[model samples]
Target chain A: MILGVDPGLTRCGVGVIEAGANRRLSFIHVDVVRSDPHMSQDLRLLAIYNGLAAKIEEFAPDTVSIERVFAQENRNTVLGTAQAAGMAMLAAAQRNIPVALHTPTESKMAITGNGKAGKIQMERMVARLLNLNTLPTPADAADALAIAICHALRPAGALEGGEREQHLTPAQRQWAQAAQRANHGRGVKRGM
Target chain B: MILGVDPGLTRCGVGVIEAGANRRLSFIHVDVVRSDPHMSQDLRLLAIYNGLAAKIEEFAPDTVSIERVFAQENRNTVLGTAQAAGMAMLAAAQRNIPVALHTPTESKMAITGNGKAGKIQMERMVARLLNLNTLPTPADAADALAIAICHALRPAGALEGGEREQHLTPAQRQWAQAAQRANHGRGVKRGM
Candidate 1:
């Protein structure tokens, strides 16, 4: 099982999925953990930390995947996002779970075959991939599901130093080819 | 007792101080908690969290004062600093201790009567204020000490909406006068 977190101060989205053989993934859980903005920063962070910690305890995920926050984004929200992301990571680490970070572009490309895919497109793709009857509500939750799927589909040894092509499963290769085609054969780096 | 933190991923500085009546301050302890940069980001953050949590447990401070982090600083280090700051806040919150945030300018002005004081000057002033025979070794440690003193000397009800001037101790009034004189009577906002 893998847990993916889309970290934010007001609303932190968490999604859990079980990955089977041959790039198969089954949705296990999805929800948003919220904290009141009126609360003090320490209490707000503690609430988010408690929420994420509870999820980790209940789910017992093997690895936790979190979005890689960048300082280049909206200056007002970046620090809060980074703080929430840190709490998510700490929750996982306290449980001795390894963590993986996936960039937004990587998640979009993994889910929708395009790095610049729109939110609706990404949500629709995530729903279809998970065979869900309804789309994940709130863009943050969908993004988290996409992040989990991205980690689930990642070829082994891709994060480390190795020839990614040699480790790609048939499904991953097919997805990579589709992503490349979607990019107009521009040669999108595999598993980047 | 107040605990001040200068948060950073590689080196988190922590200082404890007791605030006595009439603006008198006594230093208790100061140290730097460090984590290796080569470790995974989650592990590094976890190490920081553990170190801070341990300090809070040992010291049992009434409040934790952390330097407010801004995203405008060095883009590379701001996120890490924010993350470490989050951990510090969480550690305090876990123990139900109140948390205070002071900007670097506030700390500098509180210590040296100058918002733009250089590092050496600030460290010397902090040592003098603490009556320490030796200066705090690392810059981060001195910064933490400054943050603690800043919180210790802030007039009660200054953080909330109130007339700060009515609550200022004689020493605080004297310090404010000195700071104003240092700023060439530019009327620096009190307890801002």
Candidate 2:
């Protein structure tokens, strides 16, 4: 299963599917896990983590794909959103699941065949790809599903299944984390 | 050496501090990375990544700490920022160095004792910490340095140490991605 995560503080949209030949996908699920912004940052992070964890528990997916934390203008706001992103990452990491990081373009291109596709185009394509007549409600969730589908379609070995799990030796887990962290995003050069 | 990253699209702020025991960080280096917002998103991301890489190579810090990414009320603004943060993380991860992510509260607390510290309080505390005559210029740089110090003091395990490189295997690198796609975020968690 490919899990797509559209990360945000005010509203994170998530979608999951397995894109196959002819743009076919196995519809596992798509949903949004929201937090109340008025609450403390910690609470907001916790809400996203717990809510998503419940969804994950139900789906039992083998991997999680998320957009890396993005910077923004309102410095303070970016700070909060990054914290929220970290919390979401930690939730998956804590569960010992492999997480892939993709950018908006990669996802957009994967879904719409055009990296610069508009929001409406993406929504339309997502619905079409998923074989749904009505477009998915809450565009964020639909976008997330597109991202997940993109990851599923990633080249082989990207989501080698069933390795990540709790209760591994400390040394073993640390090595796994290092490898996962380094490989979270693709297409970058070997080193900065 | 601790590298501080204050990420932005128009002007990304970077500060380097070699904080030794009993000595204030006397601003080892300060630089700003500017990008044209008019460019395409891919180019903008490349600019931020290359800019950070160039800065890190020049300073050669052992640790990297960056302010967390946040979002604003505007959707387009948030989208841009998420990309920048992703690039920053990609740059930092390339070196096998952990990127310390600090929230605004923690940053303010680090610069000042109060969790709800104001900018002026932060300026004063930074002056005291670095024993400077006045608040640092380009408030963003000072903020980055302060966040670097905050990571040094707050959590140590965020970034993986270099010692574990030998334990990792080539096959285990792709673990830790969630295969389930879900849109999860603070204030935006519900209604998939």
Candidate 3:
């Protein structure tokens, strides 16, 4: 089982999935933990942290996947996102669960075969992939599901192994090259 | 007693102090909690969270003061700083300790009477204020002390009071006005 976290101050999206052989996947859970903006900052963070920690304890995911966030124009949103992301990472660390970070583009490419896929398209793809009758409410939850699928289907050694290259399908190789080109000279951070 | 933390990825500065009447203060401890950059991102965050939690338990500070950070040019640095700051706030929240945030300018102004004071000048002032025989090694430590003192000396109502306009010294009122002007139409987030 893998847990994917979409960290945010107002509503943090969380998704859990179980991956079987031959790329089979099943949904374990999907939900969002929200906090009121009027609450104190520390209290808000505490709520998110506690929510994630409790989920970790209840689900017992073998790995935690987080979506990487870039610095947006709005500093407030960035701060809250970073804080929520920190809590997700810390909760996994406290429980000794391995973590993997996937960029939004990577997750999009993995799900829809295009890095620049639109939000609605990605949501449809996620629902189709999971065989869900309805789309996940609140795009944040669907995004978390995409992140989990991205990590689950990553190249064998892309995460833990140190190597120049690894085996990849034709589509996967194309996306990898495209992502590299997109990131070239941009100085965009890959992950934490 | 209050604990101030200058949150960072590589070296997080921590300072403890006791505030007394008439603006008098005494230092209890000052140090840095460092994490190796080579470690995994989650592990590094874990190290910081554990260190601050241990300090809170050992020192029993009434409040935790953190230096507020703004988004900077380097997204990686900003993310790390925000993550560290998040951990500091979370540790305080777990213990039910009140958390305070002071901007760098506020700390510099409180310590040296100049918001734009140089690093060396601020260090000198911190040493003088603490009556230390030697400067705090690694300027981050001194920066933490400055943050603690800034919060300690702030008007009682500035942090917790509902009506901030009612209680303000001339200098403070000027600073507040200047800060508002600086942040006009920028949507810059003040610390929570």
Candidate 4:
């Protein structure tokens, strides 16, 4: 099972998925963690950290997939996104969960077979791929599911050759090794 | 003693000081926490978070002072600063330490009596105010000391009036309340 996080201060999308044999993917859960804009910045981050920590504890995902943040037009939003992403990554690292960061383009291509797919197209493809009857609400959750599915379908080390690859720190590499060791004995093989 | 943090991903400056009777401030310690730029983004953040957490645990400061982040010419630097600042804030909030944020101008005015003071002037004033025999190295540490001293001299609620006031969120307010309650029984009355 893989847990994907779409990090944001206002709304963080989270999803869990299992990739079965022959590339079949099953969705187990999807939701959004929200912090009010009126809350203090640190407090909002605390909420995200706590929310994600709890979900990771409950779901016990074998791997975590997160959207990689890059330069954006809106500086304010980018700051918030960076903070949110930092906290999410921390949550996973604290739990020794191996994290795989996918750029928006990488995730779009993996799910929709088009690197430049639009939001609606990605959402529709994610639902169809997961065999969901209705589209996920708040859009954030759907985006998160897409990230999870993308990671599920991707081969190990597939994400190691992009701008997102620059973000792979030594500690993360160590955690990836540790997570690999921990998952070796389990019956369910992590696709990544 | 209060610890002031000048948050940055590459170089985070930290300083500790005590507010003596009649407004005389005594510098206790000064240092910088750094993360390598070449490291993975998440690992860099983890290093910062761990560094600040260790400092807070060892120093047991009554309050934390931090420089508020503002938009900068370089968006990438701003994003890194925001993430580092968030981690610093989280470190204090986790320890139930009250935090006081001061703008760069506020710290400059408090240390040098000139809001438009240059870096050299601010460093000189910090050295003079702290009765240091030598100037602090790595300019970032001096700026941190200035922030700590500024918060030590200012009254509570002083930061509520500036443009920085717009950034306060509800979680910060709650942490402020909690810090207030925690500090009520301590002998060292917080300066802010």
lDDT of 1 by residue, B1-192 (tens): 999999999999999989776556788999999989988889999999999999999999988999999889999899999999999999998898989998898787677667788999989878877789888878889899899998887644343434665556454555565655645657443321
Clashing pairs in 1: none
Best by DockQ: 1
What is the Cα-based lDDT of residue B152 in candidate 1?
81
Give a tens-digit lDDT track for model 4, residues B82-126. 889888878887887878777887676566556688998888878
DockQ of 1: 0.54
Shift of residue B177 alpha carbon in model 1, Å: 7.6
TM-score of each: 0.86, 0.45, 0.86, 0.78
Give the Cα lDDT of each candidate.
0.83, 0.61, 0.82, 0.76
lDDT string, candidate 1, A1-192, tens digits: 989999999999999999886456788999999999988888999999999999999999998989989989999899999999999999988889988988888787677667788988989888987888899988788888888888887644343434565556544565566655555657443321
Interface DockQ of each model: 0.54, 0.05, 0.51, 0.25
What local lDDT does model 2 show for residue A176?
Answer: 38
Clashing pairs for predicted structure model 3, backbone only: none
Better of 1 and 2 by DockQ: 1
Ranking by DockQ: 1, 3, 4, 2
| Candidate 2, A94-165: lDDT as tens digits | 566666776676666556656688999988877876788888889879878877876654433232544433
Model 2 interface DockQ: 0.05
State the DockQ, from 0 to 1, for candidate 4.
0.25
Please list all clashing residue pairs in model 4, or write none if there are none: A39-B169, A39-B170, A40-B169, A40-B170, A169-B40
What TM-score does candidate 1 get on C-alpha atoms? 0.86
